[model samples]
Target: MDAGEASVVLEEISYFEAVLRMLCAMLVGIVVGVERGRNHRPAGMRTHMLVALGACVTMVVSNYLFVEFRPLGATPDPARLGAQVVSGVGFLGAGTIMREGLSVKGLTTAASIWAVACLGLAAGAGYYAIALTGAAAVYATLTVFEVVQRKMNVTRHATLALDLECKDLSGVMHDLNRFSVQQNATLSHVQFDETEERGVYHLTAIAVFRGANPQADQAVFLEKLGGNLNVKKLETTQY
Candidate 1:
C-alpha cells in the first residue's frame, strides 16, 4: 500500500478505537448513574455518563500523545495521564457539594462522580473487567448498603437551624425548654442572636428515637413552632 493510504487507514483505525473506548466508558458510567438516580442524588445518570465520557476522551488523548508522539529516545509515561484525571475530577466533584444552612449535602454524589471517573480511566486503559467491577461495587453500595444502614440503629444526626422572633427572650426560652422536654430531646447547645427586628435563638439539640423517627419528629416540631404566636421563621437542616 502507498504511504499516504497506509496513514489514512491507521487514522481510521485510531478513530474507531477512540470511539469504542468512549462508548465503554459511558456504559460503565450509566451503571453507576442509575444507582444515584434511584436515590435522587444531585449528579444522576446523565451527569455521571458525561463525566465518564470526558475522562475517557482525556485518557485516550493522553495515551495517543505518549505512545504515538514520543520524541527521540524518551519513553512517555501513560500513568501520569490517569493521575491527572483523578485530580481534575475533584473540581467537578466539589461543585456537587453544597451547604444548606448547617447541613451539607451531595457528598455521596461527589464521591460517586469520583468513582465514575476512575471507572472511565480503567475503561480507557482497556481494563474493561476492572471498570465494570468497580461500577458494580458502587451500585451495591448505593443500593444495598443504604437500605441496610437505614434499617440499622445508626446514630445519624441532622442539624436544624431555627430563626424565631419573640417578644422577649424569657418567653421564648420558656417555650423552647417546654418543647424540648415534650419531644424527649435535649438542647445540646443554644445561642441567642438579638437584632433590631427580633431576637434569634439558634438551638442545637440531640433527639433520641427508636429508629429513623427523628425526621418525623422534626417535622412535627416545626409544625408546632409555626402554630405558636411567639415564634417566627424556623428552618430545619439535615446533614
Candidate 2:
C-alpha cells in the first residue's frame, strides 16, 4: 500500500481501539454498579454506567481534538479534560448522600460512583488491567467488607430524644441510667430543655449501644422509658 493508504489504515485501527476502550469502561461500570443496585442504593447500575461512559467519551474526545488540530499548531492538554471529569462527577456523587436526623446515609454509594469515574478514565487511557482490577476491588469492598463491618459492630452511637413530664432532673436521670444499664447502652450525654408549659421537659441523649440488635435494644429502652410516669413522649435517632 502507498504511504497515505497505510496511514489511513493505521488511523482506522486506532479508532477501533478507542471504541474497544470505551466498551471496556462500560463493562467495568456495570460490574461496580451491580453491587450498589442489589443494595438498592440511590445511584445504582444505570448511574454508574453512565458516569463511566461519559468520562471515557470525554477522554477519547480530548485526544481526538489534539490529533485533529495538530496541523494547525493547536496545543492540547488531555489531563485538563480528565480533571474536569473528576470534579464534575462530584455533583452526582453529592446527590447520592443524604442526612436523616443524626444519621448520614449513601456515603458508600457516593464513593463507589467516584471510583467508577476513575475506572472510566483508566479505561480511556488504555489501562485495561488497572480498570478491571479496580472494578473487582470496589465490588469486594461493598460486599465482603459489609459483612465484616456488621460482625465487628463498627458502629455504636445513637441519639435518643425524650420528651418527659417531670418535676425534677434527679428522678429522670436515675431512671434513665437504670434503663441504659439494662439495655446495654451507655448514656454519653444528655441535654435538657423545659417547655414553656410548666412541668414538661425535653431530654436529648447521645448513647452508644453495644452488640447486635441495636434497634431491638433501642425499642426495649424506649418501652421502659415510656412506662415512666414522668415521660410523656420518647423517640430514638441513630447517629
Candidate 3:
C-alpha cells in the first residue's frame, strides 16, 4: 500500500481505539462523581464526566499527533497538550470551591474534579489499571474517610462569626463571655462599631470552638443569646 493509503488505514484503526478510550474515561468519571453527588456536592456526576472525557480526548489527540508526525521527520511532543490539560483543569477545580461568611465549601468537590481529570488522562492512554485504581481510591477517600472522621470524633475547627445589634453593648459582651465560658469556647476576636442610631452598637465577635460537640454548643449559645431582650438582632456563621 502507498504511504497515503497506509496512513488512512492507521487512522481508521485509531478511530476504533479512541472510542474505547473515551468510553472508559467517562465510566470512571461517573463512578467518582456518584460518590460526590450522594453528599450533595456542587461538582457531581455531569461535571466529573465532562472533565474526564475532556482529558481523555486531549490525550488521544496528543498521541495521534505524535504518531502522525513521527514518520514525517517531525519530532512531536506528545506531552505538550496533555500537560496543558493538567494545568487547565485547575481553573475548573477552582470554580467548585467557594467561601461564604465563615463557612468554606466545595473543597472536596474541587479535589474530585482534579482527580477525575487525571483518571481520564490515564484511561485515554489505555492505562486501565491506573484509571480504575484511582477511581477506587477517590471513592474510598470520599465515603470511608467521612465515616472514620465522624467515628473518631474528629475536631473540625471553624471560625464562628457573630454579628449582634444591642442597646447595652457592655451587657451583651458580658453575656457572650459567660456563654463562652459555659461552652468552653474561645473568643478569638471582638469588635464594636458605633452605629448612627443612638445607643445602638454593632458588635462583631469571632469565636473558636474545639470539642466533640462544638456544633451543639454553638446552637445552645445562640439560643441563649437570642433569648436576651437587649439583643436586637443576632446572626452567626460557622466558617
Candidate 4:
C-alpha cells in the first residue's frame, strides 16, 4: 500500500481509543466480578479485573502489530493471538476449582472467570453493547434470578445424610467422589470422626442426589460405595 493508506491504518487506533478500550474492559470485568466477590468466591474482583485487562492488552497489541508490520511483509494473525488468550485462560480458571474434604468448590467462580475474559475481548474489540449485556446477564444469574428460585422454592436436589465406616482411610475420599459421580450426586459437606479403635473411622457427609428416583438411587449408591473391601458399613437417610 501507499504512504497515505499505511498512515491511515496506523492511525486507526489512537492513544485515546486504546485507553478507552482498556478502561471499558476493566469496567465490564468489575461488573461481573462484583457478584462473585459478594458471594466470597475464589476468583473475586481484582482477579477478574486483571484477567479482563490482560485480555484487552493482548487484543490491543494484536491490532497494533497488524497495523505496524503490514508494511513490512509480516503476516501476523491477531485472531490467533486472541485464540491463545481463550485457551490459556483455562489454566487460571482451573486454579479456582478446589476439592476440600468430600466436597468440590469454585465451579461457578471458574465459569465467571471465563465469562469475564469474554467480556474483556468484546470490550477490546469495540463491541460495547455485547460486553455490557453479557455482564448484566451474568450478574442477574448470580443474584436476581437466584433469589427468584429461592422465592419459588425450587428444590431439585435430594439431600441425604450419609454415615460410612471404613477400615482403610487411604483413597476413601477419592472413592467417595467417584461413587458420587456414578450415582449422579454432589457432596456438599463432609465430616470425619475417628474412634478409639484403631483402623476405624466414621465418614459423614451431605450428598445431594439428582434423579427421577432419588430414594432408589440411594440404595444403589450405598451398594457401590460399600462394595470396596476397605468400606465396612454405609448408611444413608434422605432429608
Candidate 5:
C-alpha cells in the first residue's frame, strides 16, 4: 500500500482502539466520581467523568497527529497534550477546595480530580492497567481509609469558628471571656464590630476544644450560648 493508504488504514484501526480507550477512561472517572458523590462532595459524578473524557480525547488527538504526520517527517510528541492536561487540570481541581469557617475542606476532592484526569490520560495512551489501578487506589482512599482516618481523629483537638450577634456591646467581652473559661475552651481571633444602632454588636472568634467529646462540648457551647438573653444570634462551624 502507498504511504497515504497505509496512513488511512492505521487511522481506521486507531479510531477503533481510541473508542475502547475513551470508554475505559470514562469508566475509571465514573468509579472515582461515585466515591466522591457518596460523601456529598462538590465535584462528583459528571464533573469527574467529563474531566477524564476530555483528557482522554487530548491524548487520542496527540496520538493521531503523531501517526498521521510520520510520512511528512514531522515528529509530534504523543505525550505533549497529555502533559498539558495534567497541569491544566489544576485550575479545575482548585475550584473544589475551599475554606469553611476555620477549616480547609475539599482537599481530597481536589486531589481526586487531578488523579482522575491522570487516569484519563493513561487510558487514552492505552495503559489500561495503570488507569484501572489508579481508580481503585482513589476509591480506596475515599472509602475504606476514611473510616481509618475517623478512628484516628478521636484524640485530635477540634477548632470551631464562632459568630455572635449580641444585643449589648458593653461588658460582652468580659462575658465572652467568662464563657470561654467556663467551657474550658481556648478562644482567639476575636473581633468585635459595632453597628449604628447603639448597643447592637457582632463578636467573632476561633475556639479550640480539647478531649474526646468535642461534639458534646460543641453542643453544650451552642446550647449555653443560644440560651443567653444577651446573644441575639450565634453561629458555630466545626473543623
Candidate 6:
C-alpha cells in the first residue's frame, strides 16, 4: 500500500479505538447509574452516563493529542487529564447536594457521581476489569449496606423543638415529660413564655430521641398531645 493509504488506515484504527473506549466508559457509568435510579436518587442514569462519557472523551483526547504533538524531549503526562476529571466531577457532585431546613440531603448521590467519574477514567485507560469491579462494589454498598443500616438500630442524638399554648402549664409539662420518658427520649431543655393578652402559657421543649425511630415516636407523641384540651401551636424538629 502507498504511505498515504497506510496513514489513512492507521487514523481509522485510532478513531475506532477511541470510540470503543468511550462506549466502555458509558456502559460502566450506566451500570452504576441504574442502581442509583432504582433508589430514586437525584443523580440518576443520565447524569452518571454523561459524566462517564465526558471523562472518557477527555482521557482519549489527552492521550492521543499529546503523544502526537509532544516535543521531542518532553514527555506526555496522560494522568494530568485524568486528574482534572476528578476535580471536575466534584462540581457535578455538589449539584446533587441539597439543604432542607436543618437536614442536608443527597450526600450519597454526590458520592455516586464522583465514583462514576472514576469508573470513566478507568475505562478510558482500558482498565475494563477495574472499572467494572468498582461499579459492582459501589452498587452493593448502596443497596446491601443501606438494608443493613436500617435493621441495625443505630442511635443519633438530635434536638427537637416543641411549642404548645395551654391553660394548665403544669399538667402539660407532666404529660410531655411522661411521654418522653416512655420512648426512652430525654427532654434536655425547656422554656416557658406567658402572655397576659390571651391568658395562655407557651411551652417549648427540646427533646432527644433514639435515631432508629425518632419519627415514629414523634408521631405518636403528637397524636397523644393533640388529645389534650388546652394544647395549641405544637411543632417539632430535629434541630
Q: List the candidates' TM-scores in order.
A: 0.70, 0.79, 0.81, 0.67, 0.76, 0.74
- Give the best candidate by TM-score: 3
In angstroms, what RMSD does candidate 5 have relative to the true structure?
4.3
lDDT of 1 by residue, 40-121 (tens): 8788899999989888887787776665545434566877888888988999899989997555899999999999999998
Task: Give the alpha carbon lDDT tens digit for every residue of 65-133 in model 4.
Answer: 877787787777867777888888999999999986445888888988888888888877777788789
TM-score, structure 5 vs. true = 0.76
RMSD of 2: 4.2
- How many residue pairs clash in model 4? 0
For residues 1-239, could you state the per-residue lDDT of candidate 3 as single tens digits?
34585477457537778898899899988999998887788888888999999999998888777777766767778788878888899999899889876667888898889889989999888888899899999989988988987888666654689888998888988999999888768896699988898999999989887766888888777888899888998888767
Sorted by TM-score (best first), the order is 3, 2, 5, 6, 1, 4
lDDT by residue (tens digit), candidate 6, 79-181 = 8999999997898899889997546889998998898898888877777788789888888888888888887846655556777788788888899889887
Ranking by lDDT: 3, 5, 4, 2, 6, 1
Task: Flag regions of model 6 displaced more than 4 Å.
Answer: 1-13, 156-161, 166-179, 187-206, 211-230, 235-239
Model 1 per-residue lDDT at 201 = 45
Tell me the TM-score of model 3: 0.81
Whole-model Cα lDDT per candidate? 0.74, 0.80, 0.85, 0.82, 0.84, 0.79
Could you give me the TM-score of model 6 versus the true structure? 0.74
Candidate 5, which segments miss by more than 4 Å at Cα?
Answer: 1-13, 163-184, 193-202, 216-239
| Candidate 2 overall lDDT versus native | 0.80
Off by over 4 Å in 4: 1-3, 148-155, 158-161, 164-239
